[model samples]
Target: MTNPYAASGVDTEAGDRAVELMKQAVSSTHNNLVLGSFGGFAGMIDASILKSYDHPILATSTDGVGTKVAIAQAMDKHDTIGQDLVGMVVDDIVVTGARSLFMTDYIACGLLEPTRIADIVRGIAKACKAVDVALVGGETAEHPGLLKPHEYDVAGAAVGVVEKDKILSSEKVQVGDVVLGLQSSGLHSNGYSLVRKIVADNNWQYTDLIAEFGRTLGEELLEPTALYTGVLNKLLQDIRYQNKFSTMSHITGGGIAANLSRVLPAHVSLDVQRSTWQPQPVFQVLAESAGINLFDLESTWNLGLGFAIVVREDSAASIIGSLRELGVSSWQLGVIEPKPENAESKGYLSSAKGTHGGSVRLVGEYAK
Candidate 1:
């Protein structure tokens, strides 16, 4: 018997198969702390672990994969996008020194493609396992008419817990602190809108290779965001980094200047040296081919540095050395200086400050 719903592009059977395919991957993220089985209406995580803290504060963040999914779809790659989703969501929680507990993902698509759905979930599960976050539950919505058959969007939310007093923020950031830059794998999920625009303008296919990039454009663009949770979590436990690690700025949508400004106080300013570390090849290529000015490029992309750490001046070398031991490359970009009360700091202060924003200026020239 032919199912009437199948004719409309929605298949309950395929949905079931997708769940069946992803069950093992999802279950692998669970530990004794996760309650119940894989399929559930709501994810159950044991919060009893929080009792270990004097006062545990829960941190939650949700984010989508953005236009980067378009690149993934162009090349028929689904796995890495899920990691991008986790990187966008979970990494934000840990920015406040929170240890990620569990994550849930939502997938919306035109039809039920079990293999594709499973591939996405597998990527999320692999990332969750790497950082000890439980993948408790997820929803795959089959939007039959709204999206094209191969079109889908991925978003995820993560929950974490941190001791009340141990929470990290800009409040801890002070003048004389050293700012360290964490090297990114590639673009790390931002600036994709401009990336796609550039590719379209240049008539470049995902499979096309540029001499500088070595691999196909799709391969470089699809490089998953570097997950920092595991390493940062270790650093948080060490006494040397305890108070020295004041705050962090996850270089995302607004680039280095805007993001660091979020964690800087009004009285302080972040002076970033552009030449301290090399900008990734992708960003340099985009600037040369697209004719994007350095400042405009900084506003749009991470420009190689993914995450910024603010620490005491004495601790910079120790922190940088520790991060290197963990395979995370870092650069000592600049320092936190007092924000001049008058207009003398115009060029040094980035005007992107919000109420909490501080002056952030990029000094020095790009390392050509």
Candidate 2:
């Protein structure tokens, strides 16, 4: 009898081999709470930690590494991509004031290269350990004709827990609250499609940028996504300061203005001072070389701010100071204001403090 799976270009044997190679890499990330083995369809996590709360809200987010994967392929590095995968999803869940508990990944490829798959799993393990989450299980499919022989895509799903009363939603945000900007590790995966075009147009090789990074362009581009687990977990631990932090936003595909607007209530608007922060040099280089408009830069990339915390006016300094103490570069970026009465208004009604001694107005459509 002919094997239908083989005819379809998926080799079960190769898939098995890939799993075997990734077993150790995945197991290394397991802690006391990981249940069963590594091949389960769904990961099982011991959620007894949540028993203490009267009502525990489970926050789950799924995301891909985006076109940043192309850079990884160009650089021939796969390890850090998994961390980027986990970060993209986990950070989004955490914005709701949740603590990541467990995560799983999905890797699909036209052909399974055991070593490359293992490298990716290893990266996921490293990131899970840093965030104190266990990697319970994941899937690796080997579909020989579905993808380019050497090309693959990766995505992830993360589960987080937050006390029922502790979810940081827009409802708590109010006028007079201060916006705190947390510095990002350059680019952080989004806007890479534009980045690649810029790099190609400049006639600049990845090698040209590697010198500034003290590593190869691939290594720098694959730099693991920064984990905010510990810092946020610490801040959420203080019950007295719970209400002080009214809203949190993870700046991802949408830049600051877009993401922040998501957490703003109908009656409130965010006023960001651009001069309050400096865009990372990589962004500047890309903008100058690619001829990307400033508005596009602000709308697409994070512009160096990855995470934002909206806190009461009085708690702003303390939050910034605390983040600094934890080795995170954060600053007061702006404040919340009453939304204009005219619903048709498309502006911030105010501007960000720019680095050039001028106000920078918000130019993108708010995230609805």
Candidate 3:
């Protein structure tokens, strides 16, 4: 019997094989909390554990790998993109002071290449295991006419839990709190559209080795997003730093200012010192190649800091010490201040919004 779907480039057998190849990796992330495996109709996690909480609030987030998938396709590298996907979605939940419980991913591809798909799932499983999050289930759709055969896009949704009193929000942020900046691994999965455009403009090939990066441009850019949940989970579990922490921001699209501003309380403004950390080589290279100013660069890419936290000024030293103990490099970027009269400044900081949503700004030299 002729198979209609196979002829149309939707290979059911390939999909099945991909699932088979991915089973062990997926199963490795499962525990008693994960009720069943990925083959089920839906992913299941035993929330019975939540009964221990006086008031449990579930935090959920969904995000895609963005145009960075184009780079993955260009390099034929599928593994690390999964980590990028997990970082984008799961870390957002982490910002809410929630521990990730489970995650499901979706991949849309022009064709189902079993090995490639397996590689992607393996990355996701590894990251899930690292963060103790269950890889409950996922979907991979083969779109023949809709997407190019060589191209695929990845996205994921993560669910997490925190006690109602433990949730991190702007309400807890106050004037004089210190903003701590966590170093990024690289571009960390955002600003790839600008990255791609810069590469295209400069005629840079994915395989071309750049001296500054000390590796192929594609390899440097494809570096997996740093997994902060483990370190953060450590911080959250410790008693000393718990209540002292106010809120966190995962620097993503619209850069540090935009993402940080989303979590600021009405009266507090985030003051960022540009010289606090060194900019990675990739940012400098992109800025030079694209002729982008520091302001646009900071607004587009992470500019070095990928994750940030607002903590009571007194707790800043302890938090940085703890981050150091976890082997994560961090520094105090600036202090929260009462919203100023003009509320707008140039340099590393975003224009301050007096009260209401708040604003971030950068001041000082860009440490090369």
User: Best by TM-score, which number?
Assistant: 1
Determine the C-alpha RMSD for candidate 2 after optimal superposition of all C-alphas.
5.4
> Each candidate: how many clashes?
1, 8, 6
* TM-score, per-candidate, Cα-based: 0.96, 0.88, 0.96
Once fitted onto the true fold, the runs of candidate 3 whose alpha carbons sit more than 4 angstroms away are 345-356
RMSD of each: 1.5, 5.4, 2.1
Sort the candidates on TM-score, descending order.
1, 3, 2
Q: Which RMSD does model 3 reach against the true structure?
A: 2.1
| Residues 291-365, model 3: lDDT tens digits | 877666877899889999989999899999999989899999999888766665333233333324666677778
Model 2 residue 256 CA deviation (Å) reads 1.7
Error of 3 at 4 (Å): 1.8
The residue-by-residue lDDT of candidate 2 on 1-368, one tens digit each, is 77787877777776777678778878877888888877877788777878888899999999999888877777778888888887888888889999888888888887777778888888888888777778887788776767887788998888889888888987887778888888898888788888788778776666565444666655665666777766888887867466798878888876667677666665676667777777766666677667765556887888888888888898788877888898889988777777665533555422222211111136333221
TM-score of candidate 2 to 2 decimals: 0.88
Error of 1 at 343 (Å): 4.8
Runs of candidate 1 with Cα error greater than 4 angstroms are 343-345, 348-354
